[model samples]
Target: METRRVIFFLFDQVHLMDLAGAVTVFYESGCCGQPYELRYVSPYPQAGVSCGLSFTNLEPLEAVTITSSDILMLAGMDLSKWNHADDMKWIPWVQAAAATGATVCSVCTAAFALAVAGLLDGRPCTTHWGYTAALQEHFPKAQVLENRLFVQSDNIFTSAGISTGIDLALYLVEQDHGPAFAYKVAKDMVIYIRRDGAATQQSVHLQHRQHINHQVHQVQDYIAHHLPEKITIDDLAALVFSSSRNLTRLFKTVTGITIGQYIKELRQEKALQLLKEGHKLSWVAQSSGISSQGELRLLAKQAGRGRLA
Candidate 1:
């Protein structure tokens, strides 16, 4: 097989795993060993590459051209804070790259970047769940999938958050090589699950939390804003024009947890943040709406801080 170039477009606040996971999977598969070349490219030569945070040393995208690459991957980022001025500059280059017949792809929030280039318009695409609603708002013409891990429409591909980049890479491997080769690479990487796009993103939700009512999200938001309030299912249902039972079902679907469990988890997740910021366990409990330090300790234990003593 002839050597093919895989260029990664890195930028300030770029998601690190989106680039690392894809590059690592392909490199470890021996795809890069025989006929593949992997390179990191960024728009700013001095700005450097950071995975939504800080960085060390990275090359500039200007140093390379996507025209020469077999695959051009636009790593994901925070779409809410994305500026069109900074992003629009790359549209012409991306459009040109796509015209070259090279596969252009995005992982998570990177899908928004691809959409900016007009390449993803009228195509099936996806991004990180946190930004799915925003993606739809921006690209009304594009069919932005919500539940899938990734979507491949023609030569353009888009994936969900963080680890899904690996899944996208494996799909690419299967396309460029074969299923057997892709499987071998997955095995070497110790990846036991290669989730298809249809896999639900709500896997983290416990069974007790699987409600599907619209009011659930509304109630959750309300609870989040009023953490000090003592909320109940009935109180939440009253706000949504639905009965308690119906609200519970909807809550479970939207949040993947019952109202009580979602509240507890949200409180606990917030407690940990407070604790790390030097808040005492008792203070964390009070601020997080829990009753006692003992309950806080238990929540901490459930959060995997059991060793905190």
Candidate 2:
């Protein structure tokens, strides 16, 4: 595992939370033992932010080198207030970053920025609800998708709005690590609930985890990592230091479903993701906790997803 750099390329008037959310994701992942060298660079010496806040003593974009393993991020700001000439200066740098195989990402109206950089050209990207139309109109070459929380096009990623940056970050963490580790990051950040009314391939583990119960989140984390194992209510209860009946009751009360049902949904989602990635049926079954390919086919059939064909 190489030490990948997660670079936040900042500018004046950058939204704080949009930057903070994604920053926290990688930072927490590092704390969780996935080493990501987080770096912040800006063309501006002093980066002005929302509500008169500012960051000083920051490294310049010229100082940091973008490599293929780097994750380059652009947090959004009001396009109208943006210095178009200064913004255009970033185009060449981002183009170079992409040409070198870096993973470029934009949050909120930053998709417009990426579009301005020509990174979103011919790529399916999204932004805040209000800007999707403008994104399409302005970057006709870029395919703008509406109502998506975030859209990933090959190595490029774009997120819908402010907090969706967090979702997008979680998604990236899952891509870098695994769903189990992303689940832990989300739970630790207390963002277990998926955004309502938006369609995302948000981790299946994020579902059935809408509750804030500490023990429930721990159990869900355990279930995520141990999905391929034989999970029992008694085992989960013991892990949380509670009686099986009490833990089961509390789990259902918090998550609105029994543990068995929750496990089934998680296994289904894992199987589905594995299938999408073109894993063989036997491997999918073993990794997703299914008894066999026969059970995997049955699970896919019950979900009306073409019987794993």
Q: Which candidate is the best by lDDT?
A: 2
Q: Each candidate: what lDDT?
A: 0.71, 0.84
Tell me the lDDT of candidate 1: 0.71
Off by over 4 Å in 1: 31-35, 47-59, 197-309
Q: On residues 136-222, what C-alpha lDDT tens digit does candidate 2 reach at each position?
A: 998899998888888888889899888999988887888788777887787678776464345545455666767778998889888
For model 1, state the Cα shift of residue 90 in Å: 1.4
Looking at model 1, residue 241 earns an lDDT score of 83
RMSD for all candidates, in order, please.
19.7, 3.4
TM-score (C-alpha, index-matched) for candidate 2:
0.84
Clashing pairs counted in every model: 14, 0
Off by over 4 Å in 2: 193-203, 225-231, 268-297, 300-309
lDDT for each residue of candidate 1 in 184-223, tens digit (9 for 90 to 100): 5665676643556354322222222233333443565577
